[model samples]
Target chain A: MTAVMETAGLGKQYGKRWALHDCSLAIPEGKVVGLVGPNGAGKTTLLQLAAGLLTPTAGTIEVLGGHPGSGPEQLGRVGFVAQDTPAYSRMSVSQHLRMGALLNSHWDDELAFRRIEALDIDPRQRAGSLSGGQRAQLALTLAIAKRPEVLLLDEPVASLDPLARREFLQVLMEVVAEHGVSVVLSSHLVADLERVCDYLVVLVASHIQVADDVAELLATHHRISGPRRDSRSLPADQHVIEESHTDRQTTLLIRTEQPILDPAWTTRPVTLEDIVLAYMGQARDQERARKSGLGVLR
Target chain B: MMRFAWLQFRNQAAVVFGGLAVVAVILAITGPHLVHLYDTTVATCAAHGNCSTATSVFLKNDHTLQILFDALVVVVPGIIGVFWGAPLVARELESGTFRLVWTQSVTRTRWIVLKLGVVGLASIVAAGLLGLMVTWWSSPMDRANASMYTAFDQRDLVPLGYAAFAFVLGVLCGVLIRRTLPAMGTTLVAFVATRLLVNHFVLPKLIAPTQRSFALNGVTVQGFGQMNGGPFTLFPANPNIPNAWFYSTQFVDRAGHPLSTQVLTSACPLLESGPGPSAPAGGGVESAVPAPGAGSALHDCIAKLAATYHEVVAFQPASRYWSFQWCELAIYLGVAVVLAGTCIWWVRRRLS
Candidate 1:
């Protein structure tokens, strides 16, 4: 599939801190991609950079084959629902629809109203008075009604309750099924993305620790339990992701393309959550180790 | 984009235009009565006598309206600056709605331009219309008071100029400050500061004031001195220019130079003042004296001062009223453009 967004050596600096540093990725088209990261791991920063809400301090980024925020064409091609899914609180639902129609060249008014009606949103009611779920839905309706080629949502469901989150995902899934548009939604919750996303990028400590198709990642990574043995003794082909040991035995989550043949080890398939957590844990450890090492050297 | 911008701006425009319409009707009904009163009172009294009392009576007829309109015209620009311009971008940024609007099928430049263009033009027209109405209503009074050069900013075209400058300065303040309440505060401070600075330090110098030198023979001297010892002992030659904005009134020599206080003091010093006590025991009349030849010397110095010292006054002449209006308007419009352009640039470049 053609890439909908591409970034190379992308770095964003906020004062003395690097929010996102030396990041690189190519999000494939026609997929719901999950940009999973912990709080302050630069998920919002990455999304903002792709959405053209930010200028990269270093390197370059392109969304839909043009510089993000280059012009109306690029803007029309990409849709972004920023953190909190912002909508003008004073505006009525109908006014928001009118605004959407007037501002976007590719606006689908029928789709917009139909969705608003389906969601049972009162056209006369102000957005500020709407519930959190309703406001998120209205914001999503606005973004999707633009019929963009790519959608970037920054933690759209982070503030929603379970039922609201599920409903939101259901509506999102329906839109994707209908339009086949590319999507990248960021969240700290792996469970939120697991049900909808086909591709995943795990970010931790300003680093992209992993990026792969969900099924491919699951197929490659495994948890192997065997006799007590140092993690370093594992074969080079078995790349250990996370390891834990007790006095009697050793357990490890590892990634390898080939099937395991060692009778001494019992391997189990890993969940997406486990894979994400393992990567985040590994990145955190590496960062801590590097910091302590530098401290010792100094 | 323009349509969307209008949607966002329509409420403010409605409030402004609607409020103005109501005030306009009131002014319209009462305006003729005021002009007639001015004609019967101040105008007729100008040739007859006691025009000052006539003017006071004329002004008394609609004191409340005049006060309201005066306050409204000045406060209108401040209202625009605080409520409209200051909140234009600050509200969006504060609420994170810029991300939503900016991500739509509109470039950030186009977004900012449309917002500013529609709302800014609306702001100017609202203020301009209010100014026009006030100017028309107050023309008879302004004529009577000879107030064109005195309170120029409170009437006629300059308020519109002030409005334009204030509106743009407000938007710039909003962009720089980023938070709505803080932006509003900053806009008020910046707008007021700009107005005061220009009014006090700039407007007078825009067109060089004309200066005239006249003999001090008829100088009006009033003070506590028996001779020339008190503050006001040396007065400027009276300037004859009517309705002029006087910058300075000073005493200058025949070379057209200012005569120093030292020269006046050295020429004639103070006499010992007044009679002694009037009680029977201590009331033997006063004993005061002058040094030898002091009387002749003071008279000679006074005669020399009358002959040589000349008063020079620099003033913006009354005839330059329209010239000042246009010049100040151009300056304010120029500043408005520059500030608005910077607002656009800041929106596009630094808004993130």
Candidate 2:
């Protein structure tokens, strides 16, 4: 299958600081990809780069086999919902729908009106007065009704309440089920991604830590705990991701294709959150090591 | 795209055009009455030999409306720059809605072009209509006033170009600044400054002024006074040039050299040399009353001065009014086109 997005050495800078730097990824088609990172980890920057809302300072990015936002054709294939779900405050909901239809050649007017009607949002109400969930829904309606091949959302549910976030995810899942559009959505909350993401990309400190199919990531990564020991003693095939030791016990998160043959450790399946946090912690440690001019500990 | 542009612009258009409609109505009703008054009074005042009185009375007929229309014409372009142009792109950037609109099937180039084109054209049209109405309505008063260059900035064709330039300038500021309020402020200041600079510095220099010499015949001599016992000075009245932009008037000899105080003191020795009783103290020049029997002597002195010297007046004649209007319009429109090109280029390449 063709990749929905491909990047090589992608970097973006603002003044002296890099918002996203030296990043690379090949997100495949048709999966709900989760871009998980901490706040200010350049998730929004990466999404904007893909949506063609920003220009990379260092390298190239392509969406759907073409330069992102290169022309009307390329722009028509991808939908973007920026963070905060901005809408014209004074414009009515119906007017926003009209704008979407007017600007998009392949707009699905029926689907848009259907979604708006099913959501119980008043078509005449100004966008500024809508609740956060409704606004997100409206923005989602606009993006989806464009009939794009891919959708890029930057933290769409980051500001919504728990119930609103759930509802938003539900609507998104329905749209994905109905249209089968490839989606890449960023979020800081692991639980939110855990529910909807089939593929995972963990980002931290302006860099990508790991990106892979969720099932493959889960199958390769394992949490093992045993008697206290140095991490250097682990088998060569097992790549240690994170390690913590107490006085009498050692806990390690490892990624390897091989099974544990010695049976001296208790192995358990890790949740998506566990894998995300382990990667995030490992990246943070590497950054700290680089900053302090010290070698990686163990 | 055009429809979308119109949709976005219609509300603001309605507000401005609605106000214009009201103005048009008032001008339509009062315009004919004004023309009638001018025809009955000022137009025939030449035969009655009371033209000054007739013109003043006709000009006073709708003094408030005259001021209102002139002020409106002057201010509307700036208002369009601030309220219409500044917010065109800046508001979208400020509110993060550019992401929504630009990502649609439209290229950013097309989007910005349509937005600027639609609104910019509307600004020009609105200003043109305002200029046309005001020019037509004030024709009577303008004819009576007999000076086309007095309120030059607020008159025909120039306001249209000003509106175009101001609107584009505001768009450029908005694109570069990426914020609404600051762009609006900058547009207003820049628009006003450009208009003033062009009016005071650039417009007059566009064409070299015409210089004419007027023989000093039967004209009043303003005063004769010695300054700090240095030289006796003559202050001659300015030459009359109707409906012309007078730049300067100076007393010059036949060779165009300026007359010296020594020549004036020697040639008109009948005039007092020191600060006479009629002259104000501190060596200032006041209208010196002639000594009771010195009228013939004064006339002879003026004739002698006229034989050697004449008044040179620098001015722009009334016939050049339309040419100046066209020149100014072309200049502003040209700058506006350059600014518009810069805006498009910036929006395409630099903005993000």
Docking quality (DockQ) for each candidate:
0.83, 0.84
Show the lowest summed lDDT stretch of 10 residues, model 2 chain B. Answer: B274-283
lDDT of 2 by residue, B31-125 (tens): 99999999999999999999999888888998999999999999999999999999999999999999899899999999989988999999999
TM-score of each: 0.91, 0.95
Q: CA lDDT of B175 in candidate 2?
A: 93
A121-209: candidate 2 lDDT, tens digit per residue: 99999999999999999999999999999999999999899999999999999999999999999999999999899999998999999
Model 1 residue A284 distance off true place after TM-score fit, in angstroms: 1.3
Q: Report the error of model 1 at residue B97, Å.
A: 1.0
lDDT of candidate model 2 versus the reference: 0.90
lDDT, candidate 1, B1-352, per-residue tens: 9999999988888998999999999999999998988888888895887877887777677778877888899889888988889999989888999988999889999988888888888888888889889889988777777646866776778778778888888888888888999999998988888888988898888889888766555332211122222332353433656668888877777676676666666654542222221111122223223345544444455566776676678888888988998988889989999999999999888866
Best by TM-score: 2
Deviation from native of the Cα of residue A112 in model 1, angstroms: 0.7
